[model samples]
Target: MCVCTNRFLRLLIEKLCLPTYCLVDCDPYGFDILTTYRFGSMQMAYDAKQLRCPEVCWLGVFPSDSEKYCLPQQCFLPLTAEDKKKAEAMLNRCYLQREVPRWRLELELMLQRGVKFEIEALSVHSLSFLSKEYITSKIQGGVRI
Candidate 1:
């Protein structure tokens, strides 16, 4: 949300043609944040081209990750009515269907499963597990989407 940071990042990405990755919680708000980074805010439509990071990749804390990583039961949080509604609404967005159908399917799967988790949930294993294993493996293995 910091304009300075976004401007700096945008300049860096432009000059270097950097590949960007986004890691957010597996929740509607988190998803919104990721989209904001990739698509830019509707409020700032005037400067979207300067701010948006089109090459950004979704990096972690996907919904299916709960079962895949075997996060403890304590880490799973049931989606509220608001959460379900938000996810369902997002599912209808054309960008998801056209540009990232796999991402949309994962979002749909999240709604069907009725659960959410945070990046911190990965810490249930250990701090190093994220940097050393999950992130390293996902990036190296090209599993990020």
Candidate 2:
């Protein structure tokens, strides 16, 4: 593959046919970040086809991952009214329903559970858990969506 330089991320990744993975928190905001990376923002809707990266995959930390990784109960924070509102609005996005139903379902599960956690929550096990274990295992085991 050629050096990427400052080329548009989506175009560069597509040109190189690179495998992309997005690791974000289990919160609504993190999900928004992931979707923005995949679909571009509403403000950029006009340029979406050229800027979007449809191949990018969700890597974590999923709501279910809290249980899978054995995070303690205290690490979870109850979703605030604002968080609930954001999540509810995201669930209505047509692209989520049409293109990534699994992701939409995860968000639904997060809302139903009424809790969210940051990526740092994995540190409860150990600081190294995120890079050395969680991300490594997720990719190696094909656990990402």
Candidate 3:
């Protein structure tokens, strides 16, 4: 698993060539990821051109996730009003289930069930996927091939 800032993450996203979708936990943090990936750095990238426009979208936002997961204090960064609203909406989404917490449900379930199904879990069966393109779409579609 790779963890990085929006700038570094944007590089990986632009490398991918696919119809990308962003699946994040339904919380302030997750919404921030979407916002960053879509709107560009809310603070840092202000001086530079935005990497890409929003092409990525949220996949699932599980309410059970909030109850089950514990966000690290550092990751619990502040959120704008819009971020909170979006997170709430995502949590209430009908498509998402409380089957697992959004933050670590996949990992917890794998241990409980002895099987792991990650987006990367399908890498073997699927063609290669690029993280850069994934972010590009969500950040902005202005990226030229």
Candidate 4:
């Protein structure tokens, strides 16, 4: 489950009925990874719906969370040209507009801010900060979609 490859996830989705929650870095690549998990990749277009876990919701490390959680400024990294290109391509995906508008908004915010951070950024305060506080609070607070 750590990786979001469509072939493997297709099998997992077919066999499981549980909800899936995605926790990824607050970056274009990470956002793309989440999209792949929930929407499947174009390369696997024929099986996209079957592979996609539409029930999957993004659990953060969102760009906005860096400020919300007071993560160190040093943890934020500027988006490279390649990151911007990837994000722009993702922005054009039709499923984003039709299915996950809120997630799309978050991706837009990341592009607007031009910055990204890793899940490990939450650990600036403490090694267990993500597990003990971030993830727990986001889940309990119903902060996914």
Top candidate when judged by lDDT against the true structure: 2
Candidate lDDT scores, in order, read 0.84, 0.86, 0.42, 0.83
Model 4 lDDT per residue over 1-145, tens place: 2434655656666677555689998898889889878877777778776677777889986777877888777998999999999999999999898998888888899999898899998889899988998889999999987
* Residue 91 accuracy (lDDT) in model 3: 54
Where does candidate 4 stray beyond 4 Å? 1-16
Q: TM-score for all predictions? A: 0.91, 0.91, 0.35, 0.89
Candidate 1 residue lDDT tens string, 1-145 = 6667678878878899987888899998898788778778768889888888888889877888888899998998999999999888888877887887778878888888888988989988998888898898888988788
Q: Candidate 3: where are CA atoms >4 Å away? A: 1-16, 62-145
User: What are the per-residue Cα lDDT tens digits for candidate 3 across 1-145?
Assistant: 1224544556656776445456654345654565455545535555334453355545533333222333233322244566545555545533234422343443333223322122332223234432443334534753311
Superposed by TM-score, candidate 1 places the C-alpha of residue 114 at a distance from the truth, in angstroms, of 0.8
Name the lDDT value of residue 68 in candidate 4. 88
**Candidate 4 — what's its lDDT?**
0.83
Better of 1 and 2 by lDDT: 2
lDDT per residue for candidate 2 within 1-145, as digits (tens), equals 1113213667668688878899998999999988987887777678667666788899998998877888888999999999999999999899999999989989999999999999999999898989998889999999988
User: Residue 108 of model 3: what lDDT?
Assistant: 31
> What's model 2's overall lDDT?
0.86
Measured on C-alpha atoms, candidate 3 has an lDDT of 0.42
